[model samples]
Target chain A: MAEEMKVIYERPRSWANKVTHYCPGCTHGVAHRLVAELVDEMGLLDKTIAVWPVGCAVLGYEYFTFDSVEAAHGRAPAMATGIKVTNPDNFVFTYQGDGDLASIGMAEIVHAAARGWPITVIFINNGNYGMTGGQMAPTTLLGQKTTTSPLGRTPQTNGFPIRVAEMLAQLDGPAYIARVSLDSPVNIRKAKSAMRKAFNAQVRGIGFSMVECLSTCPTNWKLTPVESMERIRKEVMPYFPLGEFKVAQGVL
Target chain B: MSDKVLMKGAEALAEGAIQAGCRFYFGYPITPQNETPEYMSRRLPEVGGRFVQAESEVASINMVYGAACAGVRVMTSSSSPGISLMQEGISYISGSNVPCVVMNAMRGGPGLGNIAPAQADYFQAVKGGGNGDYKRIVLAPSSIQEGVDLFVDAFELADKYRMVVMVIVDGLIGQMMEPVEFKTKVDVSTLKTPEWATVGRHGRDHANVITSLTLDAAGLEKWNLKLQAKYAQVERSESRIEEYQMDDADYAIIAYGTMARIAKTTVRVARAKGIKLGLLRPITVWPFPAKQLQAYAPKLKGALTVELAYRQLFEDVQLALCGKIPLGWFGRGGGVVPGPQEILAAFEEQFGKGR
Candidate 1:
């Protein structure tokens, strides 16, 4: 008997029915899925406005079913601040990369967290600029080598890497700040949990919330997807340090 | 007519914006324009609107882009240096085709020039200071009253074209006080919300996505063409010029903003001396008043571009004339505001050179 297999798992309704443009083995797919699934589960798909930044996720609108806007390079925090302040009833979140949030957009992100704007920030730290072809990002480890840093980054030449979760946690404004990794299934589940907490923090109208996802970029790193996960687990996790930096009362 | 109340130009412009239904104001304080944000901070809360003093001009303009994308009337104000910081954000806003108003209370600058009145930013205002092919509808108001009145028109035109609109004034106008009557009450409910605005779906089939990135060259070309068509329509329907004593004159003085006010007095002085000079004040600087200036070009011997900058507005005057008539230029820069006497001397310089 030819029995039809029942569908146990499927795409979330909040995600578009199309192929994403992410590179092979890129964890942006995983991050996007977590966001879409949570948006659907929380019944915020209709009232959420995702502010995308100028990075690998610049075309995020194509994959999201809800309303989205594109911010200029590194200006997503400021844009999200405007959207959240004007439409207080709507949920606004900014999905940004290390280059977008911690580099040129440093001022915007700092001020947004300092102001305690009730918005969620999903920070993807891949250690290098993924869209611009493997340039050293602000989150690049001290000794990591990139296209721009062929001889490996030095403390004097490249400066110390910014720990965004820890930096933002110092501000009195943010309600929740956490750093999570996606190097394995256990960490992937933990990353999703952190994102859900960040989203709920916005829903509670507590303050700004951010989840720094230690993602992978096999194409930029010149490594296989398996090796990339190994790198995140071995190299990136030690430097980035996974844990909640700040948790507001009742936010989690 | 309503009773005119004494108001500073910046304060009057703020009132005008509020009346035009601008519910969100995000700005960083700069000299000569700080009063605008100060006024907004006090007034917006009364109307259940929001006012944010941003960290920098860069963040301020992005905030305007954010609020504007969510289908609200938003604005930001700054002086020349601060405005330069906002160009990148302005380019993004225009590229994304959002409606908002930016006010520049001009001061002299290639750098941090003094916080005095100057119209040196004419080129930056009209000639797409930011990267990419985009146009901003620029309105230059010479007086406090005119500046106040243009706010209503600026927001209306921004919504009508779904593009950026600027109300440009010099620092003098921003700081000076005058008895102004804001009689026009715009009913914002009558205006249609933009079809593309990102208002979260209460009950809609799809969501609105506002973005400027069109990676495909063909897709980007299509977007550029749409912007060009809309700009062409604006150029045809919204060109504004005020001709003073242009009917019987042998020479025309082309100016705008504070320069136009000085040119008015210059025209009177020159005409009293029977030099047969007239004034062509452009209210809409981007549209350039080219057609009206061309019509009077045949009757004039030559045109003189008198401005606060070295030769910014003169370039536009030359473009409009297209070498049909000889052009003369004179101006002051770096926070120097020329008087009617100084302008009259420049007119004599042009007349002397012609002979």
Candidate 2:
């Protein structure tokens, strides 16, 4: 008989087999994997409807096996709310970038959270507009240089970075709000756990839930993938502290 | 005995939508159309429907987009300025090929001109207001009763073509009250959820994904061509016009919405004064009554286009009967409503004072 070798690990069932358009070592792929894994692990592959934002992840619908819709830039939260309210039994979530969510989509996100629409939001903050070729974003830190901020951002010129999680946690609508990073394997596990709780919040029909992933963008940051991870660990993590900001009772 | 009830135009249109099986309404309050959202807020919940007063017209249309993607009957109402804000979402909905209804209570425009009634958004509605080569089926209702009746056709046409069906009326129609009978009550329970709706995968072999982004040039071109073909079919089959007293008429006055309603009185006035004038009102403005107007070009000496905006409706008449007939134009802007007698005066002035 042949050697009784068995597969130890396999790809998540909810993840599609298509190759992603993300650049090498881009954390968007990592974030996508985490979402797909949770969608599979939580048995939400069939009922989940992903609202893809108008950014690098505009084509995010392709990465998942579940149903999806593409929303206009910064309107993903409103669109996801539309999907959730009309089909209350279906699971709806939006995947957005910092510029898409924290910049142009501020009102939509704020109002959606305030309305307490039971929807999950996976916000990827990399301090720049990655799809539009690295412009300074609302989440861009002071003294960080982007294509739009060649001399480094200053509060006098570019407004200070927004702490989206902390701000959203102030709202009474969100049942869970957390900030996590994808810098290391340990932190990646933590990010995944936070994502699970956020999903669980929606699954339990608690309220609005969000996980702001402090991700890296090697191409936009003009740094090596290793340096990007280090930058998140040293710089991004300080401004956007990693931890749960709001947790409703019984949202484990 | 008739069962018609006296209802405000905005409230009647809302009830018409509910009767037409539209269970999802998302809109922001705007002048001349605020009663629509207010009525929907109370009515939708009573009928086991959903109502969302969005933060802005942008959010409202996006919510409409979202509900439409889930393959349900959804709608939104706004005036000129608010409708301008909705153009982006409308374009996305058109590009994504989802079905929804939108109502525009025409008001003075260019920018927040006034809350008074005007038909300045003709180009914005009948013509392509949003980017790209997309078309919306625009229904111009001239009266409160007609506006209420058109809501049924609006939702039906939206679902039939998977395109946006706009019911356009002047602010007067939105604010006015008239005896209206809800002739059609579309049992919402009979409506089937579309197969393309992004509700969930269920047990399907493939998941449904609704998007308008076609990265490849050839793919986008293909999509555009497909949309153009659908528009061509709509234009060929769906053009609607009402010819009021056109038989043996020496002149015709072409108009729509409130302008056409006044033009009907103008027709009676001009005929009484022996001008033999008739009114040609376009009910479906986008799939414009071009062919109907073209047919009358040979019979009439001339046709005068009247509107609430300067030369907006005339542009379409010019395009349709440019060389075939002598075309005349008369309009007022900035919330000016010309009386029937004034329109008759303009018609006589343009058509050489009594043929």
Q: What is the C-alpha lDDT of each candidate?
A: 0.91, 0.93
TM-score of each: 0.97, 0.99
List where candidate 1 sits over 4 angstroms from the true fold.
A1-8, B189-192, B352-355
Q: What is the interface RMSD of each candidate, in Å?
A: 0.8, 0.5
Provide the lowest-lDDT 10-residue window in model 2 chain B: B345-354
Give the per-residue Cα lDDT of candidate 2 at B205. 87
lDDT of 1 by residue, B1-355 (tens): 4789999989999988988888899999899988999999999999879999999999999999999898788999999999999999999999989999999999978799789888888889999889999999999998988887888899989988988999999888988899999888776577566778786776678989999899999999999999999999999989899999988888889999988998899899887787888889999998778998889877888888998998889888988996788888998988888899898888788776222
Per-residue lDDT of B225-314 in model 2, one digit per residue for the tens?
A: 999999999999999999999998988999999999999999988887888899899999999989999988889999999999989989
- Evaluate model 1 with DockQ and give the value: 0.82
For candidate 2, what's the RMSD?
A: 1.3
Best by TM-score: 2
TM-score of candidate 2 against the unseen true structure: 0.99
Which prediction has the highest lDDT against the true structure? 2
Docking class of 2: high
